[model samples]
Target: MWSLPASFLLLLLLLLLGQAPPSRPQSLGTMKLRLVGPGSKPEEGRLEVLHQGQWGTVCDDDFALQEATVACRQLGFEAALTWAHSAKYGPGEGPIWLDNVRCAGTESSLDQCGSNGWGVSDCSHSEDVGVVCQPQRQRGYLSERVSNALGPQGRRLEEVRLKPILASAKRRSPVTEGAVEVKYEGHWRQVCDQGWTRNNSRVVCGMLGFPSEAPVDSHYYRKVWNSKMEDPKSRLKSLTKKNSFWIHRVNCLGTEPHMANCQVQVAPAQGKLRPACPGGMHTVVSCVAGPRFRPPKAKPGHKESRAEQEMKVRLRSGAQVGEGRVEVLMNRQWGTVCDHGWNLISASVVCRQLGFGSAREALFGAQLGQALGPIHLSEVRCRGYEQTLSECPSLEGSQNGCQHENDAAVRCNIPNMGFQNQVRLAGGRSPEEGVVEVQVEVNGVQRWGAVCSDHWGLNEAMVACRQLGLGFANHAIKDTWYWQGTPGAGEVVMSGVRCSGTEMALQQCQRHGPVHCSHGTGRFSAGVSCTDSAPDLVMNAQLVQETAYLEDRPLSQLYCAHEENCLSQSADHMNWPYGHRRLLRFSSQIHNLGRADFRPKTGRHSWIWHQCHRPRL
Candidate 1:
């Protein structure tokens, strides 16, 4: 043990004792601030502070951007963009530590701000304050980082695929089952199967887009090749172009995101001898499609015979359309995909499969709720042209050992529909359903507020559904207090809406101009569930072509058609139905090429009647 001088120890004790009690003991020592609560983003949440050795909530009374800036900076963010009250991130428990809080926005910590002292508040849990900080500047959310090789001897694996050389293999869905071929340097080359194992096949299957790998009959392949070698016109010509084997003796652990992550060799253990494959032929692999790819009762072939492709893929736990946690169906059960090889191209495939355009963003780390059910797919590889997600390649989710935390999600490119212009839905498991919110002006301030439920019915919901392009109204709900999504959406804005059932949108219907509600203080917003198996309206072009004719009809005889705005502008300017106008006439057949029958939004009696009449004097 080392000895310290008695004079040095006395001086240190005297210096500490001479220092007066620190002005902000909590800020210098014990006080710690954090964002907590559920259904919130990482950069935004309910504010909680550590005081007296336990976590406590902050009251919203007078809490503004200045206070939020201090809280956010204390929590390691750049600063606060905005602040929320009314438990926007959800309520918090424990003591309400501070009330009537005030900050100059330059405080280094929340404890430095003025308050009614710690653990003293008149606010309830519902009044917990929250803050939204600026999002992180950069993050790799889709594909995870991977090295080209396990060691310095190799580089990152970028591309690989399957080449179907067999006559039958060429007929499948881009050949779900085929020989494994990898891209190296600049050419597509074969992988020698001399010591190829299932682990190697697993990696290959993942690269292609299948969920799992199956066994291939090597004897059958060899038997067919021996008999077909004499035919120059056979599919074997595809193989003759590539005489070189680029890879040999691959050893994969089956969990690598790409084949390049596994061990590889330029030559075999036996040495680089002629007839590279030797006793073994080129590597062959068979892929098993996930349930998501295998649409129910789908006709097998490369050509699609139906009017529309069935969708087995869906989004969940998203507040709006085109963005959500990705879920695919298998055996009538829904599951999530792991973000192993997830990227924008792969996400775009899933998006287009669901009738959207492309993926605007590929999300990772389960930004939606922690997924439920099995992880179905992983290591998905998409070429961006496939009509359905199943047409791409992927690996089984279980093979990658992924958890709910790695569940992949996507934000798709949706049609330019104006549904969100005046209305929106929130707080639902999926964007297809939620509590309805309407944009309204309150005291000259325009904001989103809840719609009153009086006279709300399917007639109104039908317009809402059509406006969203989500098909038809399955349910129109009142008293929607359970789906509490947006915090400020609880403010009741307008009431007494009555749709005529034929309106194209909810706003076109009649409603009270003044703000009114039976439950102004409650979260009783109108809600809806939309499920549209819309009847396909297809014009019979063949019929129209055969029966088409051009005629010069007298404008006076076309009064009804002209009044209905069916005539061109030339007719609108013509001498009062006295001149002749050339018109194209055709007899056409219209077909309902969909699962549901076409039904009018309103009864025939409610339809408007238009008739030709003499011009008013």
Candidate 2:
């Protein structure tokens, strides 16, 4: 054996001399990868290598199961396999640097593919990351699908018969044992018990494991049949008594053995043995007697009872003798009155209708309140007599006043007959005429003036002044006053005139005169200075147009197309003293007017129009 130092030295020399250690596999590229295709479930897909910075296809030359499994795992697939082919799954024309990739099945990604500690690839472009995944199963192992696939044909079911099973039994089983008697076809039949509970009797019978029948309540049979046997006499209570009667015969079916097929025998009323009666029947039965003689007709007077009289009294008041009565207007029909809204007028009218004295005071809103009945009168018109309140048309909103002012306080002198029952008319003062005036001015100059009777109201004065072609100088004239100066000397007469100091001139002062007599002074003293003058003609005109693209160009260019015609017309027709003319154009050109690009911007096209005006020019 060699010494440890000598052996280590020999090993070091050999490693350095020339036998190189095995190389480790390296990833062909460092880049991210993704999948793309139709049916390429997000949970599974083939892999493409992102090498050098660009995505490229991998060749399948050395594609193996381990590589495919890694790619599938990246796409959320737990178990996967790789398939490499020249078929059209992926682009087969790109660089396939990954060749013969050998990966430990445990590697997380294709980049981890390595052999002998060194990365290697034998994959061709055709192998470009193709993979198939075992997707997670959505349904449980023994789900409906499994059941459907297995089918009921292979399973056996216990059969039950419904013929003898109780209708009320639950859960029937084929393996049950017992003796069950059921009512069927009107008879009780005995049967063998299967897996039958009271609730499932029907299903068990339907399954042929047991037979079921309509269940009869034991209590019901006791009450209906057993009771009859125990108390035979009580059962005959509903039967009619007779000397003898025929009895019904019935077949003794399996369910009802008590009944039998026998003809009923009934004897004649007086010649047969009588059966004992039932418990409800006594030896002597009681019955209601038949109706007797007809009821008497209602007496004529009885038909009109005191209640009717009270009702009538309650409905009518006799204050106006008989004029007051409650009357209802309903369905456009009138009958003997029902009282409502009946007061003085109502009573007065009713009293009058009854030919009673004048209605001194018709009272309502009292203790004897409203009554109900048919309305006899719809509308009543009373001339203080011979009419019911309902007949009086003017009762509503009619005002009547008596001049008995001091009568309430009078205690002597026959009460002075204090204007009682007398109507008086309301009074007021009449409107009187005042004063009026007319003044004129021209070109801001005082021209003429006049004063007229207050009879010449403002409206009339306005018309008269306008007819006279007088521009109003002053409208200060109110009521008529006295005239005190010569004609054209600015003095006028008017009546009922009252003024403080707002007068335009003393020339409009009142003249001293007798009552109702008046005159006017001034150039217009005779009246307004009537003259015919034609209104001066004046002209002012403008032309405008609506256009598009206004924001990109000047308005001048918008109107430039017609600018020459506009200028020519302006110079020739609207120049100087004749008239004024202006042109306006709206367009998008304005948008570009101040911009460096100052070019006409293209926009929607439109047209232009002109507005011309001549004012008495």
Q: Which candidate number has the best TM-score?
A: 1
lDDT of 2 by residue, 407-513 (tens): 01000000011111111101102111112233333357543333444443333333333322232212323332232222352433333322222221222233324
TM-score of each: 0.31, 0.18
**Relative to the true structure, how large is the alpha-carbon lDDT of every model?**
0.68, 0.32
Looking at candidate 2, the ten consecutive residues that score lowest on lDDT are 406-415
**Positional deviation of 440 in candidate 1, in angstroms?**
44
Candidate 1: lDDT of 150? 25
- Quote the lDDT for 108 in model 2: 60
Task: Please give, for residues 1-617, the per-residue lDDT of candidate 1 as tens digits.
Answer: 99889988877887888742223324543356767765325567889877777888998999999988887766556778999999988889889988778888998777777777767667899999989986432221113223412222453344566778677767655356667776655666777888888878865765555535788888887776666666887655445344566678789876554566678765432343465555666788887654324433542212321212356787765534456778887877788999899887688677656544445467776755455568999999976556676777998899969997778888654433233477888887787898877776678988887778878898788777766656567689886767875886677776887886544356556788787777664656788988634344668676788898998878766646766665555666778757887767788676653334668778989765433333433
Model 1 spans > 4 angstroms off: 1-145, 148-152, 227-243, 267-275, 298-617
